[model samples]
Target: MFLAVGLGNPGTRFERTRHNAGFRVVDILAERLGVPWKSEDRFSWARGVVGDKTLYLLKPLTFMNLSGEGLLAFFAHHGCAFEELIVIHDELDFPPGVVRIKIGGGVAGHRGLQSIVEALGREDFVRVRVGIGKPERRELVVDHVLGVPEKEESIILEAAEKRAAEAVLCIVEWGVQRAMNVFNAREENGQKEAC
Candidate 1:
């Protein structure tokens, strides 16, 4: 079994926030797979088959900063390997419509990823990062991420969420290297292709 964990804060207050992009993508995946989420031990998850692989979609309920604690518990319960895990989260570095896949990298100051690295004791797991561009001013960083997206940005992000779901399937069907090659490639104009 492979684990696909989507990071986000719990509660309706954060439902539509830019920082919850990972949750949104997981929702899209659940929809596509015709599975319903079930709450279980500090997280909610759904199981489905993707190209002969059993995929477990996880959403940590301990909020963003404590996401790793929940994920680690799930991993221990399921006896899953670190390499069989894929983490999906919002990225502040790229534009709002971008999605990228990579394996093992610095967390770029993301507290949720930091906690995951701390708990996992390694950084070699796969990552599927959806972009939610940074604020112009440093002081507005928190507000920018927690705030709801503008109408146009929301539309873009929603579409990106669908793409992110596709990327997850690509990883399951084709492996991370091919998923990265397909999902991380840029167009001629330097825009990322939505794989």
Candidate 2:
């Protein structure tokens, strides 16, 4: 069983925020996956089955900063190592719609990832980061992450989530290395367009 976690906070109020991009990716993964996910035993997440594999596509309900609260325990319970886990989250530093995948990298000041590292006591897992666009105002990082994306920005979201959904399928169907090659290192950086 591979654990694919899309990290984000709970609540309808945060539905369209850049911070919730992870949640959007999870929904996409569910929709396009070859196999279906049925209600199964899970914690702070949802379980879906696909192609002889059982996957846990989770959206952390513990808010951004405390994402690992449930995942760490869940990992241990199932004897799944940190390597078997794949995390998806939003990145404000990169342009919107860009997806970056890497293994064992620092959080780059993301509190949620920091929390997850602390909970798991390691940073050797796969991370699928959806770039949600750079901050217009540097000091407003918190607000920007939590703020809702604008109507014009919806296109960026669409592109990034679509890529992320494909990345998830790749990760499960192929492997981390293959997914990284296809998802990351894209020829275009979310198809950068003039503002």
- lDDT, candidate 2, 7-115, per-residue tens: 7877789888888888888888777664444332334555676566777777666778888875765665556642368888998778887787788889989887888
Residue 71 CA error for candidate 2 (Å)?
A: 1.0
Question: Best lDDT goes to which candidate?
Answer: 1
lDDT of each: 0.87, 0.76
TM-scores of the candidates are 0.93, 0.84
TM-score of model number 1: 0.93
Q: Assess candidate 2 and give its TM-score to the true structure.
A: 0.84
Candidate 2 Cα misplacement greater than 4 A, ranges: 33-43, 76-83, 187-195
Which pairs in model 2 have colliding backbones? Answer: 37-48, 37-49
- Of candidate 2, the 10-residue stretch with the lowest lDDT total is 186-195
lDDT (Cα, 0-100) at 184 in candidate 1: 78
